[model samples]
Structure formats: structure tokens, C-alpha cells
Target: MAALLAARAFLEIRYLAGDARRVSEDRSPEDDLERIRFLADVCHNMPGIAQPRPWRPSRRGAPGSSVQQAMAKRPMGWAWHTAGPEKRAWMLRHIENAGLQWTPPPPLPARRKGPSPMTLRQRAGVLLGRWPVRPPAGHLSLPPEAHVLKALDSDAICALYEEAGRLRLGLGKGGPWLRAHLDADSVHYLVPDPASYYWPGMPSTRGEIDWWQCTALLRMCDGEQVSGMVAVLPETFAALPSTLPRRKQVRLVHHARTTERDTYLWGRDHKAECDPQLCGFVPETTGDPPPDD
Candidate 1:
């Protein structure tokens, strides 16, 4: 802006009327005028624009500048962008010497956005079925029966994952529910991962269906609407406190927390530092990484 102002001022002083007929314009005299304007516009205790009072654009139509004369110049732009290179360099140095230190701010970042919690719950609504018995491949189905709970929440549904139980989805219509799953049958397929020091997920040995999918499926049956979120390990590593509370049975309920963001397994990266009994997993051998080109 200072540069723009200085350039505009130069345009007015040189091309427009100032000295009646002819003034070759000696540097020393003209620069003194610029220094005075620079002081008034850019220095401390500036009139009506200092602290507690901001420089308002509506009043001036442009950002405050070192060269006040530029703000008054008839047309904005007015060849300011196309000004001679030598004059531009001179104006830049003039503004720089006048204590102009800031660069124009960069553009703002894009907003963070995604599916809302209700939308997520709706998504979870679609993943449900009888866990032990899947319906025919072509049709979408719910549970064998639906229970109308006075109230249901994440905690209520998460409890089923901790040990065992059954869940069903229903049609508001008439009789039988759409789908169902035997919650205990899920645990038999799970192996406690010592390295994680807690239950990791609803991973299965029998099929590709895993914790991420299971979490969504279970949320659909909960008495309350549940967010369709799943546990995720960050690309970076951090320590996760034991989800398994001391002296209590290991449970998968912690993953159901809405505030839960990243889950970590410290032993995955620092196996030697973690306790063997609590965090040990047999190490798998891997070939050395190939060299970078």
C-alpha cells in the first residue's frame, strides 16, 4: 500500500499540475516533501488513526499509506502499477526508510468440514444387520426386533461390546425386526493385543469385518442416536493411556466416546521401552527399506 501510495503521489507530482509551467524537479526538495507526509501518515500519534482508533477504509477508500498525497490523487491505480522501474525502486526505498515493515497478509485457510453427527448416525443406521446371521445379499436389512428404550446413549451401546449381548433393528411398521447380531460371538474372534495394553478394536480372525465396521454396526442398534465414528491411528505416533482400567475387565467401550480422536499404541514404535507383560507382541521381521533414488 505504501508503494502504491508513493507511486500515485509521483504520478500526481510529475504528470499532473503542481509547478505552473515547468519544474525539472530536483531530488532534494521533492524528497523533503515526501518525508514530511511519510511522518504524518506512518509515524506514531498519527491524527485520528492511532491506537483506540483504527484506520477505516470507508473514510479513505484505501489502506493508509506513507504518502498521504497518493490517497488524494484523482484516480486510483492511475499508472501506479505501470510506473517506471527507477521510480518504483525509489518509492520502495522511500517507504522502507519510513518504517514500513509489514507485508500484506496471506489469504485465509479453507474451513474444516465433514458429515455432522446426526448424518453420521444416519450412516450407521444403514450398516446394521443380524451379526450371527446376515440377510440375503441383495436387500438392506435391520434387526430381528427393535426395543423402544426410554433413553439410550453411547455408554449403553458400548456396554454390549465390552462383554456380550444381542442387538436388533426394527421397522416402525408391524412385527419382526430387520436384523440382529450376537454381541458375545464377536469377542470369541478377538485376540487381546498385549502391545496395545488395551482392547484395540473389533478385529476379527474369521473375516475382513473389523472394529471400524463393527463400531458403526453397533451404534445403529443403540437406544440413543450415536455418531458413526471409528477409532483411527494417526499417521504420527503418541502414547494412549490404557483403556483397560486397572483391576477391571478390558472393554471396548472407550472407543465409543465422541471426543475420542487419535488412538495410540506406544509399543508399536517403542517396543523395547514398554513393559513386556503389558505391551509385548511378538516382533515380525521385515526386510530393510530400499535406498532412496
Candidate 2:
């Protein structure tokens, strides 16, 4: 029984060795040529690296086989022999431009000192006698009666306002404009002229607001002239040590104080939003208006 077990173990070891040898032999000459070409290209691109010599097949080993014939015709040198199977496989994938030849990257241009050149649009505006209007600096001050429901971190606020009807405060020199639900479906906006409440430093095209940089300013009175609304931070409802309790009673106002003029002029030029729901489709209309406004 001991002899029989030893024989079985020997046979298993021989079988594994045979399998490994077969796998090695199965690699085609084309594969070796590809590897050799890739390595040659890499060596050529990198300075001071020695190029691999071509592979020459042994006449004693499978002399008439296609692989041997191919190797005889074009020998791929000894460079690939040192690379393990895993390394060879990785090299195959990362060979630049199919191992044709290595092209060195162009050198970067010299940097110019001082202010950058004006854009074509800016130049054109000047040529047309239109002076560029600069936006005001600082945060847009809220109305005297505006109430802060809660204070929270930026991430929490962005998540909370991720939904369709969230409001955004655009700070400008003229004053802050309360844009109604960010992605609501109202045909008409509360503020008709968008330029009047220009957001400072915002790109000409629509840009996103960082929730951390903004404070939620809600109007709490409903005296016909006053708009009653509430802005709450998401962190206020989260499970954190510094989180504040979520506010109640105050309604989420979806009324926009300004409409995008370009939307009307250009027939609704679609702007991509981080949240897909905020883009293209109008948000479902819900939430009651605050009483007394």
C-alpha cells in the first residue's frame, strides 16, 4: 500500500510537469515575435536601456515545426526569456501603438509671465465698443427677515438638495436672487430678468454651486409682498455629533426668482447636471405655498 501511494504521487507530479511543458510549448512564434518587437520599441524609447537580441531556435528541437520555421526566418532575441509569463502578458497589453516604433513626447512650451492673453470673445466685445461688465465681489446678503433653518457641511447640503425642487442662492453685486426649485417644471420663473441677479465669477454658461460656500436663506413672512420659504441642510438630519435637528413647518418654496434668458432665446439649451433628474425633465410639482405670501 505504501509503494502504491508513492507511485500515484509520482504519476501526479509527472502529469503536472507535462501540463506545464505543454503550456510553454503551446506559445506561438508570432507571440514571441510580438513580445520581442514590443521590448525593442520600449528599449529604443527609453534612454540608456539595452535592446534585446533576436531569438534563434535550436536546430535539434522540433526542426520542421511551424514555430521553429518562423523562428528560423526571423529570430526574436533573448530579452523575452528573462520575463515571467505574467510580465510578458502585461507587456502585450501596454505596448505603445502596437509596438510599431517609439515616438518621444514633445517638450512643453515655455511659460509666459504676467496676465494671460484675453479670449477672442473678450477681444470681440472690446472691438464692438462693448465694455465687459464685471460681477460684484462677496456673498449676496440675505434679506433682513430671512431665517436660517440649519447649518451643515457641504456634502450633506448637496445631498439634501439633490432632489428636483431644491433652491440655489446666486450671490452677486446687485444682491442675492432666490431661484426657485433648481429643477422644477414651472413655465414662468418668479424673477423674469436673470441678469439683474447675476452670480459673481460664474462662467458665461451655467455653472454649479458649491453647497458648502452657500448659506440657506429662507423668507419666513407671508405678507403678500414677502415670500415664505425654508432652506435646510442635509447634515441637520444625519447621524453626526455636530448635526442639528431637522426643521419643521416651513414650506419648501419652488418658485424661481429668475428665469434663464438663454433658455427662452435658444429654445431650452440643455445643460448637464450632476444629478440626471435635474437635467432635461421638469420636476414633479408638489409642496404647498407658504400661507400669507
Candidate 3:
């Protein structure tokens, strides 16, 4: 009975780990649920094997000490501990091998593409209803080091920023708003932090330090939920010379668009109260800081 139980546990672990590998490689949330369901089913079938449980690492230190610790810490794979220590170690090795297999291939070198041009009217239409999505256009083409910024019509950027005001939610520290609205230029783009995503020139150029980059930063920052003090912030498009002129400094006012404000209020009573100025940080600008409002 013990031998059969051990064998069943091993099979269950392999199946669950395989599911986890698929989810990790594909990054499909649906796959994650499927993995969970499979694990639950395994626990149901293998009555002698301990039921799946959450992994809880020891607070003292030395994470991944035991199967219990590892399972507790992981978002998935809690069923590996059903067997003895030797079996658990074997299961872990298999899981590790699976991880190596799923390791993402190096990103294909970026080939610049498209004109990505839009008139002010078109930009407005994007902002009001749909996301501004156009491949590089005009001189822009795949291969050359060129990029374009398309503006979304809705105040999605502003809304994301305001909601993140109270909570610090992100893969890491508080980051720049991935979505941004410019009262000065009346433009929007996706601006993510240079550090968050893997890129060639992350520290130097902030991983695509352009208009779209800034917009994504605002959007990312806006959605981040912070439990403790925010350690880092994503780069700002508002401070970028490409987006904002050097001689001019723009005040990042809390946007007055009631619809977006109400939509993404960070548990604030009044959306108007949610508006706060951007942090005081200088960009990689050549000249002195722009005049503050």
C-alpha cells in the first residue's frame, strides 16, 4: 500500500509540475486554473497521499527548506509534499528541469516598424473610444531603430494613476504610470518603467524612453498597490524632453475628467480629492529643471 501510494504521489507531482510549466511558459491565467484543478483532482484520487495544502515558508529564514515550505511559498504546486522527503526531493528536481525547459527564448532583436502617424482628430477619436493602435508608418519600418506612439481616447491613463495612489500594487516597487495624459500637449501613450521589463538599454535609456514609454509608466504606476513605503517609481514621460520641452515644465494636475476619476477612485470619497501632483524628480534632460507651477 505504501509503495503504491508513493508511486501515485510521484505521478501526481509530475502532472502538477507539468501543468505549472505550461502555465509559466505560456503565461495564460486559464492554464493556471487548470493546473489548480488538476492538483485538486490528484488529492481527491490519492486518498493515502496527503491532500494538497498551501505552502507556508518559515519566517526565520532559509526559504524552500522543505516541501511544505516550498509549496506554501509558491502560487501553485502544493501537492508535491504528499510523499516522503526523498520523493519530494525527486519531485523538486523534476520541477526544476521543467522550469529550464520552459525558460523563454531570448527576445528577437527589435526591428523598428510602421509610420504610426495620426492627426489630432484621429488622436481624439482614439482617446474617446478606442486605444490608439497603429504600426509604425511613413519613414517607420521594421529593422531600423524607430518607434511610434499611439494615443488612446479615454482617460484610461489618468484613471489608472489615481487608483494606485492609495495601494502599492505592482510586480515590484511603485512604478511610473504606464498610462498618462498631458494637459500641455493633449496626448497619451503607454509608458512602462525601464526597469520593469527586460530591455537592452534599461538604466541608460529607460527601456524605450519615449512618449509611449511614459504613458505606459503612468498606467503601471497608477495600478500599483503599495503596502509599505514605495521604494522606486517608474520613469515619467512628463519629464521626458521628447515629450515635454526642456525650457517648459508642466504641472501634472490631477485630471478633472469626472468619468475616469470616478471609475478609478482609490477608495477616496471624492474623485476630486484623489488628484495629487506628480513626484519631484528630474529626467535626463540637458538643461536645468523646468519652472514649477
Candidate 4:
């Protein structure tokens, strides 16, 4: 894993250097940054590469160059060169002309009502059943709308991945659930490292998935808004006390109650009770540890 990661990074640096040399003949510094950013996004988003922050497309340059002129058009060679063939193909799906263009997938076929919790084996079978193991570079494709329906007929497999992340949060570390592999039945397969430990707004290397990040990803894929209720890993990885006592829990419950009440009163114009037991949140009146522990 480490070797593959190093090689990918080395390839990126080489590609950036080569691109800089090639484009320098006609482009300026600002153009170089834009190109680099595009390539970075492609590489960083790939499953194997680990980095914080995805590629950020920007047009600005150091103090004296062109400030805001629209960038010169170029083929997505930067993306193709840095990203693996699988990613290169995915990026191509979004390309319009030589640039990336967001094309919302056509409306999916209406979902079929179905059973739940298909195992890793089942999903691998379905994915393989639908497409060849590998397609030619830049030629790979998603199944047609009807076919996607048949393949992911139930959202359960993905849901299991999400649940795995959540369980990790309470456990405070990786365990069997976090290690659940994704692939056809009975044997091993690859799964992307959980995104929980990642810093928000940044790309992160592959590692055990974080529950909060899993929650967000699941919501994004399902096209739903994320809630603030999801908890983040503490900024510092300092060891915390194993568990708080009942008094602390009670205090937290009270604080949550008050906070919830005030929030509802001011925002929703409703007088709502803050139930420590029901909501698991303490009112502000009590200074307590976070309920997440």
C-alpha cells in the first residue's frame, strides 16, 4: 500500500514537472497553477491516494501576473496524466470539450422496492455481473439507468458501510466493523478507507473510516442534507477519560435541554421541553461533557 502511494505521488510530481516544462512554451504561471490544481483533484480523489483536500481550481497567480483573465483552454491532459485509468475515465465522463463540466446524471430509473442487507459477496457479484473487470481507458462507463437500478436495487450494502462508520465513533477506534471488506462473497476485496479522520474541506489519505465522515458521505450520495448532529473527532488525538460518571452525564443532559429549548424558542417560535433522557442532551444549566462519549 505504501509503495503504491509513493509511486502515485512520484508520478504526480513528475507529471507536474513535465507539464510545467511543456506548457511554459505558451502558458504563464497562473495557467500552470490551474493545471496543477486540476491534476491534483484527479489524483487526490482516487481511492488509493491519501491526501488532505481535493484539487481546488483557481485562476490567481503570484503578485504580478495576469489577475483575472479567463484561462487558456487546454485538454484535460493534466488529469489523464496524473490519475489512474479508472479515474481518467471517470473524469472524462464530466468533460465537455477540453474542460470538465458537471453533467448531473440523467434521472435514475424509478427505484424498485427490495430486500435489505445484501453482503459484500452479493454486491461484488452484482458489480461484476454488470460490467467487465476493466474497460479500455477513457472508455469505461456507468451502467444505463435501468441497469443501475437492477444492480443497486437495495441501498443496504452502502448503508452497511455507513453503519460501520457510526459504530467506530462510539468505539473510539477501528475494530472488526471498520474492517469489513467489500467484495464478492467468501473472499477478500478492497474498500476505500473510511473518510472520518479527514479534515473537512480537505482531502485526506486512506485510513480507517471515521463515522462522522461516513454519515456525510452517505448523505451526499443519497442527495440529502447532512445534519449537525453528527460528531467530529476531537481536533487533538489526546487520550480522553474512559467514561464520565452519572453526575456528568446528568449535567450534560441538562445543558442540552436548555440549549434545545432556547434554540426552539428563538428559531421556531415554539416552547419545547428539553428532555435529557429523550434527547440525550443536557441543558446549558448543567456544565457537562459531550454526550457522544
Q: Give one digit per residue, the lDDT tens place, for model 3 in 1-293.
A: 22344455556557556756665575465765665564445444344334444443221111222233333343234344334465445445554655543222232222122112344654454345422222322222111111222233226444444444443322222223222213222344332212223222233333332222222312223442211111113333233324432111111110111012211222222223323355222223222211110
Model 1 Cα lDDT, one tens digit per residue, 185-293:
2221111111111122223453322221222222222122222222212110112122322212111222222211111111122334433253222224321111110
Off by over 4 Å in 4: 1-15, 18-24, 47-293
lDDT of 3: 0.31
For all candidates in order, the CA lDDT equals 0.27, 0.29, 0.31, 0.30
lDDT of 4 by residue, 87-170 (tens): 555455434434545432332222122112444543454444522122223332222211111111113333343444464443
Lowest-sum lDDT 10-residue window in model 1: 169-178
Per-residue error (Å), model 3, residue 89: 3.3
Q: TM-score for model 2?
A: 0.16
Best prediction by lDDT: 3
Off by over 4 Å in 2: 1-98, 119-121, 127-293
Candidate 2, residues 1-293, lDDT tens digits: the string is 11222233344435444646447677665655565554444333222122324443221111123333433333332223344565444444444324434222232222221123444654454355432222233435322222223333323333433431234432211110112223222211111011212332335334632212222322211111121222222333323233222222011111111111211111122222312243222324322222211
The superposed Cα distance between candidate 1 and the true structure at residue 245, in angstroms, equals 21
User: What is the number of residue pairs that collide in model 4?
Assistant: 25
Q: Could you tell me every candidate's TM-score relative to the true structure?
A: 0.17, 0.16, 0.18, 0.21
Per-candidate count of clashing residue pairs (backbone under 3 Å): 11, 9, 51, 25
Ranking according to TM-score, highest score first: 4, 3, 1, 2
| lDDT-better candidate, 1 vs 4 | 4
